[model samples]
Target: MTRMVLGAGTGLAVAGCSREASALMDDYATVSQAANEPVAGLTLDNSQLMGIREAGLQRRVSGFLSREWSDHFVTLDNGAILVDINARALHYWSEDERTYKIYPVSVPLSEDLTRTGKTSVVQKREGPDWRPTPNMLKRNPSLPAYVGPGPENPLGTHALYLGWQYYRIHGTNDTRKIGRKSSNGCIGLYNEHIAELFGMAQVGTQVLII
Candidate 1:
């Protein structure tokens, strides 16, 4: 139920009314806290969360998650979607509709760091440029490189700045690489899939990472 607004003044900023936000968070908490050792928000279980319930879904079923079918944008509260920047996954729950969807994605990271441990959607931009921060430069002395937006640019299509961190969950030129935990730290998503995610999210949203 985490609502992520799209096309806000900041462009891709997420917002939501408290009532709606509370419902989504509560549900997410239920899922994340299911095993008691919850992380931040929710880490979806392919079995219960996905279509792993039906007895007939054994042989052909792919753990309720796969490249097709469940491969869709997940909208969170206030018009935001829960983005798995590492696994390049998007998670959302249908509120009035009463259902949930998950999708594989690809996002780019800041050029400053050689790699990253994880990523988040804390900061956002319209056509953002990669301005390597001092800390980033500190990580890589030869950094502070300015990687602008465009084709051939490391930030392939979309860009979701990671708060103050020098990372982003954006689109990528690499389409073949998705649904895996691969990245210096940023989330890489397929071009079309991320577009669906970007369309579903906005600013001021809470991006909980596990």
Candidate 2:
């Protein structure tokens, strides 16, 4: 598993340990070999590395699905979002395609911070401002009371608020954090991927976080 240390303050910059850093070296090699086959003259960079990591995480999630839920990859709703916390990935069921596409995501680093079971989208927001909850403030008193939308905002550019208490499928400014367990409780995805997902999802869309 990837181990990372969360920095203090509002933005929560992620810093990995030596083990993770070493694993990332292997990740670069694996991603580069795959890229060479599909795209000529393609080299792996930090951005691409993150994408590769997401894809790798998705594969692991797929393996789990194959073993446990062979017939289903998402919620019963055609437009639902299924979150696999154990695999640190989110599967978005595309209505038009009639299939699910997995995306790398960040979940609560500690199991205690995460909640499981079914929910639905209650609200959605673009360029959402982030307000540190009381528990978050308790953990990090130095954190700002509120952060407006911008690079520093943890909620990124879009947020799909869930029916569960204080949980949402949101974007993050820190793309590197994706594929790692780092969120306070909510699900975190790359801003670009979230932008795509935000458009497909709607109010009352089912969400199952397992």
Candidate 3:
């Protein structure tokens, strides 16, 4: 399967409502629809792609089918992030370049997490503090009150706060956890990957967790 790269073309130039905005929306819609379809002449059975078959995941995620970012997300045209839990990957769309770059990531282990949907980046911070939520504290009472920015900090060096309740996309001190299911309902990226993504993202950037 071809990588998820849209041809080099200009994306939304100026932010806000305009004709370009409408065209970008239409372009994304076309892209989304195409993703759901199986690519012709590609035999996925023996193909070895990044998101290829995992022992116990759904075919939609494990197969060669290109799972596009959902229609519910609105800012792919102006730059956005899509997190595919089953694939354990984050797709970063650069609005200016009109291209996407995939990064291996970690997601929540719990299957019951219901935070999947569209949301915007509410805040972004570097050298972020790690404050465990009350629920996280309940799950593990030994958690410290907070951890300041440093190598010991679980949030790593960069963090993007989500519009959803208490969720964030942040870097991790443990790089080994990337490309696995080992997070507390938040998206976890390698420190280097998060640094690059942080430079690409901004406040109000759309995030789609699928």
For candidate 1, lDDT tens digit of each residue in 1-210? 323221111111112224432332222111110111111122334443333224221221222132221333244344334554444455544333343445544333333323433233565554455554565457556543676765434445677666645556666543333443334455555455456556555554434442
RMSD of each: 15.7, 10.9, 14.1
Candidate 3, residues 164-195, lDDT tens digits: the string is 87799998765545555666788877677688
- Model 2 lDDT, full chain set: 0.62
The full ranking of all candidates by TM-score, starting with the best, is 3, 2, 1
Tell me the deviation in Å of residue 189 in model 1: 1.1
- Segments in model 2 whose C-alpha atoms lie over 4 Å from true places: 1-78, 96-99
| Better model by lDDT: candidate 1 vs candidate 3 | 3
lDDT winner: 2
lDDT of each: 0.41, 0.62, 0.61
How many pairs of residues collide in each model?
Answer: 30, 0, 0
Better of 1 and 3 by TM-score: 3
